[model samples]
Target: MLNLSRLSTSLTKHGAHKIALLIRDHDPDKVLSLLWGKVPGINIEEVQARKNLSAGTTGLTVPSVWKEAKARGSETINALVLIAIIFSHHTLIAAMRQGAKSDFTGRITRDVELDGKAYTNFAHTLEELGYSTKHTQQYVDFDLQRLFKIPDLNSLALTLLALKMKTAGWDGTGDLKQLLIDNGFHEVFATDEDQFEAWLSSGKLTAPSFEDADYFLDAAKDSAPAGKYKFKAGHKTKQTGSVSVKSPLTKKTAQLLHNYIQNKFDEQLVAIHGRDCVGCEVATGLGTSIDVVVETAKLRWFYEIKVGKTLKACIRQAIPQLLEYAYWSAEPVKVDRLVIVAVHKLDKQSETYLQKLRDDFKLPLYYEQFVDA
Candidate 1:
C-alpha cells in the first residue's frame, strides 16, 4: 500500500515540479486523469511546459530544459529529466514493469507487481516526445539505482554517455560533469577535468556489481571521496618474473628500439592519412595506458610497443595488454587491430601461434617488426 500523496510530495521536494507541469500542459486530459487516479483526490490542470525559443511558423518553441539539453548535445538528458519527474517514486521496478516495454520488462514483471498503469502512459508519452526505448531504460535504471542508494550509477551513466558522445564526435565531458554534480554525484565524480576525461577514455567506470554497489554505498555513508575509496582493481595479469638488474647497454637498446619503432609508425600514419589521423596514449581500464593509438576515418589501431631480446617475450606481454584494451573500450566499434610493434620479427613458433589465433579465434592481430638505420 504505497501512499501516492507521499510519492507526489517526494517528487515536488526533489525539484520535479517544472517537469510535472510540462507533462500536465502537453499531455492529453486522459493521461492526466490516469495520473490523478493514482492519487485518488487531486483535481487541477492547465500547467504548461516551459517555452524557450521565440514563437515561429513552426509553432510554440521547445521547452528551455530540452533546448538546453539539445544545446549540450544530448537529448538523453532531456528524456531522463522527464522520467525523473513523471515516475517520481522511490523504486522503479513497479513503474517499469507495468508501464515500460524494454529488455528489462520481462525481468521486472517476474519480480514486481504490474499495477503502474500511469507509468506506462507516461512512458508512451516519452516515446511520442522522441526518446528511444533504450534511452528510456537507461534513465529508468539510473533513477532506480539512485533510489536504491547505489552511488556508482551516476559515474557509470555519465561514463557511458560520454563514450557514446565521443564516438559521435562530440566532447560531452563538461556538460556531463556539471550534470553529475547537480544530481548529487559530486563525491564519486568530483575529479578534475583531465582525470575525468581519462576515466571516460579508459572505460573504467562500468555498471556496478553487487559488491561494487555496496562499496559505493559504504563510501557515500562515510562521506569519503571516491579517490580515497579503494576497490579491487580488475585485469591484473599474473607476474612471470621478478625485477632483475639489467645492464646499461641492454636498457639503452630497449629504449632506442621502442622510440624508433614508434617514430616510424607515426611517420607512416602521417604519410597515409596526413591530418586525418590522430594518435595518442590512451589509458586502459586496467589502470594502465596503451603505448600508442592511431585513429583514422575508417579504423582505430591499438599498438603495443615492446623491445625484448626475443619476439616471444614481446608478444607474450603485448597480447594480454592489447586484448584488455580492446574489450574494455566503451566505443561502438571494437579495436580494429591488435598490433605488436617490436624490434625484431616473430620466429616460426610465434608466427604459427599468431596465424592460429587469426584462423581459429578470428582475432585481428599482427606483428610489425622495425629496423633502425
Candidate 2:
C-alpha cells in the first residue's frame, strides 16, 4: 500500500529547503529544472553521483558548487518557491528509486499495460498516472513533480489514492482523475487516514528526504558574509500610511527577512512538530494577517515579524497587531504565546520592559531575534 495521508503533516517549507545539498537556492531561471537530470549549474558527474547514492543513507552530499552563481542571479528569490522546488527534487528521487529498485511486485492486478512488458499492477499504476508516458526521464520528472504542490497537499493525496487503489486491484471502474476531483477533497484524505497508516508502520514506503533533518544546514550560512551589506533596491511594497510604518520594506529586504524566519525559526519548530500545523501570512478574520502561526499539541503561537527595526521599535510595532488579531478576531481564538521577532536582540532595558508586560500585565509576550547569516 502507498499511504501518504499524513505525508504533509511534518513537511515544512524550510525543511524542504534542506533536503538536498545539491539543490540550489532556486534561482528563478532554474526553478523549473528541479528534476534530477534537468537542473542547470550541475555537471554530469554530479548527476551520476547522486543517482548512485541510496535512499535514506546518511552522508554529506557532494553537489556542484553554486555559491558564486546565486550572488549573480537576476530574479529576486521567493522563499516559498525555493522550498517548493526543493521538495520537487526529492519527490522525483523517491518515486524513481522505488519504482526502479523496490522489490514489491505489487499485488493489485491491472487492466492496462505499459512498455509492452513489466506489466504488474505497480507498473500499470505508474502508467495510468502518466509516469510511463514517452518512457523518457523527462516525462517521469514531470509526472513526479506533478504529484505534490506545497500548501496544497490534495495532489499528493490523490496520487497516493491512485497508487493504493490500483495496488488493491481496483477494477478501473472510474477515471482516476475524476474520482479525485469529484470527491469531497478534504474528506478524501480524512476518511482514509487510519486505514492506510499500516503502510507507514510496515515500512512499505520510503520516508521523504525532508524527514529527520538532523544534519548541518548552517554551513553555507556560516561562510556567508556578515550583514549590513547593501542590496540594490528592486521593488517597494512597504506598508505605508495608516496601516503600519516605522519600517520600510523593499522587495529584496522583504525576501531576505522572510527567508530568515523560515530558515531559523519556522524550520526548527517544524522539525520537532510538523508542517501542517504551521502557517505563514495567516488571516485572522479581523482584517489583519499574521506573519507566522505555529500550532502544536499543547499551544498556538502568533508571531509578528519585523526587520530593519531596533529591538524597542520592533516590539512596539508588533504588539498592536498581535493583540488585535489574537484577541479580537471574528471568532474565539486561543493564543498560547505572542512572539515579537526582529533582527536585533533586546537590550536589558527592553528585556525588562517585556518581562514587565508578561509578568505584571499578564501578557504572553516574548521576544526572538535573528541576525543575518
Candidate 3:
C-alpha cells in the first residue's frame, strides 16, 4: 500500500513556490494549452521532469519561494490554482501506481466521474481566456481523464487546499476560501460556509472525509437541475427505520436497565477488590467514543452497553464496537478485558461465538448479561 503520509510529505518537498513560479513564468493560455495537450511541443511529463530538477537543485522551499513571489507582485490565487493542478497530476500518477496492484477500480471510477464534471465546469470558466467550447469539451472527454487517469480538477483543488491546511494551519483570514472561489470552486463555499469551516476546524480531513465530501457534493448536484444547484457543505444525513415510538416507556426502561446493570457491576467490583471502579466515557481518537470504561485495581474493562430485545441482538450490536474500543484505546494492553453488557443472557450461538473469540483467537473479550429489576 502507498503510505499517504509519505506521499503527502513528498508533495510538500516538491515546493509549492516552485510550482507557482512555473505557472507565473508561463502564460495562462500556454499553461492551459499544455494541460489540454494543445501544445504539441510541450507535454506534462517534460514539464514535471523540469519541475523536479528545479525543486531539487534550488535550496528554496515553499515559504521562501512564496515570499519571493509576493515581493515580485505575483498573483497568489493564480499560483495556488496552478499548483493545485500540478499536484492533481502528481496525485493521479501516484494513485494509478498504487491502484495497479489492488482493487481501486470503483474508487477510481467514481473520482473520474465527479472530477470530470468539475473539470468540464472549469473549462467553461477557461472559455473567457480563449478556449473554445469544442476544444474544452474535447480535452475534458479525451485528454483529462485519459491522460491523468484520476478525478476532476475541482476535487483536486479541494484536496490540495486540505493538504495545505493540514501542514500549515488556517489563519481564518478567508484567504483560502477566496482562493477556492476565484478558481471555480464556488460550489464548495457557496452554502453552509460556517458548517464547512467548522468541519475544517475539527481537523478530520482524512482521505475518507474528502471522499465523503465529494460524494455529498455530487449527490446534491445530481438532485438539482443546472443553474439551480445548491451544494450543502457536510455529510448526508443517515437514513433510519420508520419504526414508531408511540410511548417513551421503551426508552425509559432501557435507561433504567442500563443504570441498574452499571451499578451492579460497580458494586460487585468494589465488594471483591475493595476499590471503587471508576466509570468514564473515553474518546478513542478513532472517530468513536467508548460508552463505559471501568478501571479497577488490577484490570481495565472496556464495556459496550446495549439494551436490545434479546441478548443475542445486543451482543451482535456491541461486539464490533467493544473490539474497536479495546483495540484503539490509548493503552490496549492495559485493557485486560472486553465486555458486552446487556439486559438479558446471550443465546447459545452468541455464547459460542464469544467463547471461540476468547479461546481460539485468544481475545480478552466476553459478555456480561444482567437482568432488569
Candidate 4:
C-alpha cells in the first residue's frame, strides 16, 4: 500500500494539485464543449425570422436568458468543479507510475496536509457514488465514462479530489524531480547528454530538446555521442517467394476459420510457415503450417490448425500437432490460455485428447465446427 499522505504531497509537487485548481477555477461546461468540439457560450436564435434562423446571425440571447433563470437553482458551478477534478485525476494518474515506492521521505508541511484533506474530501464524495480506489487496481476494470450518463461532474470532482491527495506539493512546487531522483532514478534526470535525451524521449519530461541539451551540457558537461540511431525502427517490405503447404483444409477452409476468429475477437491473425514458424515460440518444429496467433491487450493465445480435412487420420494428427504447438507456445508466450478450434464432426479420440490437454496442461481449449456449405 502507498502512503496516501506522502503520495498526495508528491502529486502536489508534480503539478497534479495545480491541475485540480485549474479545473476548479475554469467553467466545466466550457471545458466540456471544447473537449467535445461544441461551441461554447450561450445559445442564440434570430429575433424576427424565428423559423428561418438557425445557429446563424440575426439572433437573440434566448438560451442565455433561460440559462440565467436556472443558473441560481441548479448547482452548475459545483458540477463544473467536480468535472474538472475528475479530468485532472485521470491526467495525473496516467502520466505517473502508480504504486511505486518512495525513495525518500520528507516533512509533511501544512500545504501538503491541505492538499491531502481536499483529496480525501473528494474521494468521500465519490465513495457516495460507485467508483472507488479498488477500481484503480486493474487496467480495464472500469470505464470512467459509464459512471454517469452525462459528463459526470460529480464523479470527476471526486476523482480529482482523490488524486489531489497524491499531488506532490501544496502550491505545485514540491520538488518532483528530486522525489523521482530519490526514488531510485537519480541517473534518470542525470545531466549526461545521452541520458537526458533518453529520459526526454522516455515521455517523462515535456522540456524542449534544445533546452534539455543546453541544460545537460551546462550541468553535466557530458556531450552526447553523434550517431545514426533513432528510437523507432523503419518497416521495409520485400517481394516474397511463392510457397505451398499440403493440408486437408483448402483456402476456403482457412478463410472460414480466419473469418470466425476475426468475428470473435475483431482482429486478424498472422499465419506463418516454414522459417517464419521456426522463430516463433508458438511454432517450434511444425512440418509445414502454424496455428493462428491471437494477441490481445492482456494475453496472447493460439488457435491451432484450420479444419479442412475429413480424414480421421488427418484429424488425429491435429491434436498431437496442436499439443506440440501448445507446448512450444507456452515456452515462448507463457500463454494463459491454449485453445484449439477444429471442424465439428470429430472422432471420439480427438475430443478425449483435447480434454486431456486442457486438464493436464491447464490450457484454455476451444472446439468448434465450421459449415461453409
Q: Which lDDT tens digits does candidate 3 get at residues 259-299?
A: 44555555554455444454434555544445556665566
How would you encode candidate 1's per-residue C-alpha lDDT over 82-117 as one tens digit per residue? 443333342332344344332212222212422254
**Per-prediction TM-score, please?**
0.32, 0.32, 0.31, 0.23
Clashes of each: 1, 0, 1, 19
RMSD of 4: 24.0
After the best TM-score superposition of candidate 2, give how far the Cα of residue 315 lies from its true spot, in angstroms.
0.7
- Pairs that clash in candidate 1: 99-120
Q: Global lDDT for candidate 1?
A: 0.43
| Candidate 1's TM-score | 0.32
Better model by lDDT, 2 or 3? 3
lDDT-based ranking: 1, 3, 2, 4
RMSD of 2: 22.3
Cα lDDT computed for each candidate against the true fold: 0.43, 0.41, 0.42, 0.33
- Report how far residue 219 has shifted in candidate 1, in Å: 22
Indicate which candidate wins on lDDT: 1
Better of 1 and 3 by lDDT: 1
